[model samples]
Target chain A: MLSSTVENYLKSLFLLDPRGEKEVATGELAKSLEVTPGSATSMIKTLAQAGLVEHRPHYGVRLTSQGRTLAVHVVRRHRIVELFLVNVLGMDWSEVHEEAEQLEHVVSDEVITRMDDLLGHPSHDPHGDPIPSADGTLPTRTLQTLSFCNEGDNVSIARIGNQNTEFLKFAEDNGLLLGRTITIKNKNEIADSITITTHEKEVVLGLAAAGKIEVEHV
Target chain B: MLSSTVENYLKSLFLLDPRGEKEVATGELAKSLEVTPGSATSMIKTLAQAGLVEHRPHYGVRLTSQGRTLAVHVVRRHRIVELFLVNVLGMDWSEVHEEAEQLEHVVSDEVITRMDDLLGHPSHDPHGDPIPSADGTLPTRTLQTLSFCNEGDNVSIARIGNQNTEFLKFAEDNGLLLGRTITIKNKNEIADSITITTHEKEVVLGLAAAGKIEVEHV
Candidate 1:
């Protein structure tokens, strides 16, 4: 089993440059890890030796195919655990991120398989992130950012952004998660908030929040 | 927050020497972690510095008051995660251990509290191990060994001694688990097979399998 620190490094690297074909800057990785350049330097070298990463010092790092596989596995585990926390454990939507982050690295394929079964083989998590299929194929999506839509356009939420809790609470409070309709009641440019009616409640989403969310034309 | 690896070390120490509060021997820890003595020594030093453990060379390690509190938290998380996997995720009872082991370190107090609520604050996990309450109190009970049970003794599984799939299959085939009730019908002293009636199934539990089970007489 990989250490949490190692996995975190790999996850960050994968997120920055998922396919080994792209090279990430070393300083960027160091910044993302919140570690000194020296520590990141040593660990990246180690990961390269392990064949989990391909690092070219100044040019940065990328996950090898083996490493990408592992990163996706971790991401799938994170999303599955998050959904389980919300849909099954009854956790508040605002609270699943930190918990899932911690759990994603520890659960095994056996546990994940069972989780998938328990969730009725859900195609998406409670937050609208796609749940990778059994074979690790993520469902391809064609979603648009709500901020880019015209003022009167009707849209449906396709995915919620994986950011902080305030955003999640705002989204949940508005019932603007996946498969929910947003009528784009109004866009307030002065205050930079968008008004949308959902589940019979009016939500004033900040332009920043609306920008983060992905939507599809209705 | 302690990492799962660190939490596992603390929990292992807690379980290995629950009564006396004696220091855990390095050799014993190495055995449990499946690492070398030198590796264990190095890690213990790190743990001691981190204030999670106290170490004396020949004497085994022990948890400080702070460490004990952390261990209790990990235990709470593990039991909650296990219950969530089973009750919510629809994961098989046999598959929850590793997942719980990883998740125990990362879940938040909010998630744990809510999980307890969703489960109606279950007092025990699927393995019949008492779950520590939100306040960290474990219900005291004297559990018995199934191997030593006499004829007509009604027993419920407390914890499976091992997590091998073979054990799970056997338990599943016979409808035996943490809450299963069993009445010992006959014990073959020669062939070492015990005939037991569980629910409506008359099953023969081999000595090897029966020996690995811990039970409680009701």
Candidate 2:
């Protein structure tokens, strides 16, 4: 059985380049894991030895066919668990990520496959993150950021970049969730703030905050 | 946040002494974790620093009041997940344990408390293992072993020691689940196999095998 830490490394590596199907950098992995460069180096060596990660100095890390499959499976398990927690268990979307991270490593393939079937091949989790198919294929999507719109352009909040509770609560406090439509009203002359209209409510967000949200045209 | 490993240690300590009100032996904990005595010593020290365990030399380890509470909460999450898997997800008993172990450390207290309410305040898991109440109380049960019965004695299979897939499939093939009655017809002197009658069929099991099964008087 792979340890949760190793499973996380694999997932992070895959997430870095879902289709790069190529090598990834040690520095990028360290940033993702928030570990010391030395520690990431040591772990990558361990993972390489275990055949979960293939490292090439400047080229970065790549999941071998075996590693890629495992990463996909873990991602699939995580998304399914999130769906189970929210759609069935009534847990808040923000709370499911940590819970799913812990469960994805322990449940048997049998349980995960069963959960996938029970969830009816869901396309995305509560946060609007695409759930990879059992075979590692992600549904095609063309997502745009709320900040990518011009004044008076209307769009739907397709997803958010953050799943942290504080962040989701912040979004909720501002009336953001999947399928919530927002119209960009205007941007400040001197500052980066952008104003938006949604659900009969107005939200004033800075440029960085506006960029934190992803949206799709209505 | 407690690492699942630490939670497992606290859990093992608590299980060693049903009353968290007592001390546990280091050797006992080592045996439970299949770790060396030296490793247990090191880990117990770590746990103590984390305020999850208190060690009193040869008397072994005990949970701090805080640790005991955390252990109870972990166990409650575990059994509630087991119940959810069995009752809601229709997962087999054999598959719930490992999943519950992973889930226990990750799920929030609110989710578990809600599930406890949804499961009708179940007193036991599908395997007849006592489910700890929200108050950390184990319901009193007076279950006995099926093998203890003499010839012509009738009993219902209350639980079994093993829930591996092979065993579950074996039990299922023999039409045994909770509430299934087994009446001992006779004992073969040579093989020590007991002839038993079930709902609509009769079967024989070796003495050692039947001894592993727990039962309740009908």
Candidate 3:
């Protein structure tokens, strides 16, 4: 069995290069994992030796197909666990991510499958991130951020790009939840803020916050 | 945070000396943990230094009050996870022990508390083992095994003392479930077997199997 540390590394690599289209620099990997470059390089070498990754000297590293398979399973476990914590256990969506990180490595596949069944085989988690299928296939979709929506455009919240607790709490407080439809009231380029109407209430958000919220046209 | 190994040792000690009234031999601890006596002694010394156990060289060791509290919490996690797996996930009772063993080490306290509420604060798990309360209190009750019951005694299955998968599967096959009431129709001492009636069907079990089933008077 892979240690949680190894699983975390693989998952991070998958997230960094979701399409496996390019190699990720060791420095970037270290920064993402909050580990020293030396530690990341050492682990990358180990992964290379195990044929889970291909390391290019002075370039970076990319996961091998075998590594990608394992990484996607970890992602599947993580997203499924997050949804289970929120939907089944009634935990706040903002709080479930931290809990899911610890659970993803330890939860058995059987239990995860059962949870998936109980959840009616959901395609997306609470944060609107796509859940990898049981067979490790991840569905990809592109949505525009709220900041990019045109004035007077009606849209539905698709996903939250920023998952930080404070950001999620703020979004929740402002009623910016997944699948909630709202009209783009105005976009002030000079002020770098966007105004939107939800539940007959107009709310203004800074461009930075608006950019983190992905939305789909109604 | 205690490593899972440390938690396992502490939990083993608690199981071997539930009342914490007597010192347990290193050899016994080693046997229970399937580890060498040398390894057990090494860990015991470490635990002693941590003030979690009182160790006497050439004799045995026992948990301190502080150690007992931590041990009970691990037990609580294990039992709650087991019950959650069985009741919520719809897993077979005979198969959930191994899953719970891994999950108990990594699950967050908040998640476990939520699961406890979901399970309605169950006092006993699927196998009828008592679950430690959230505050580290364990309820103890004494009951007689079926082997000691007199012929014609009407009893309800309170707990299954044996947790082995094969034994539990056998019990389930014979409809010997928790809270199931059965009549002790006969005890053949010479044959070393006991005959019980459940659901108007007479089933015979070896004396050893009967000894592992704890029951209470109906």
Candidate 2 lDDT over residue span A59-159, tens digit each? 67788889888898888889898887888778888788887877788777777777777888789988888998878888868888776778988899988
- Please write out the lDDT profile of model 3 over residues A11-63, one tens digit for every residue: 99999999999999999999999999999999999999988999997799999
**Model 2: pairs clashing at backbone N, Cα or C within 3 Å:** A24-A60, A24-A61, A25-A60
Which pairs, if any, clash in model 1? B23-B60, B23-B61, B24-B60, B24-B61, B25-B60
Which one wins on DockQ? 3
Clashes of each: 5, 3, 0
Model 1: CA > 4 A from native: A1-10, A13-23, A27-66, A171-180, A183-209, B21-30, B35-65, B90-93, B147-218
- lDDT for position A117 in model 2: 79
Place model 2 in a CAPRI quality band: medium
Q: Compute each candidate's TM-score over C-alphas.
A: 0.77, 0.87, 0.94
Query: Fnat of the models, one by one?
Result: 0.96, 0.48, 0.96
- Which of the predicted structures, 2 or 3, would earn the higher TM-score when compared with the native? 3
Interface RMSD for each predicted structure: 2.3, 2.2, 0.7
Worst 10 residues of 1 chain A by lDDT: A13-22
Which digits, one per residue and each the tens of the lDDT, describe model 1 over residues A1-218?
Answer: 88878888888887676445578788888898899989999998999999998877777788888887877777788888888877876777677887788778777787778777778888888777777776767876778888777778888888877658887886776677778887778887888888877767877777887888898897
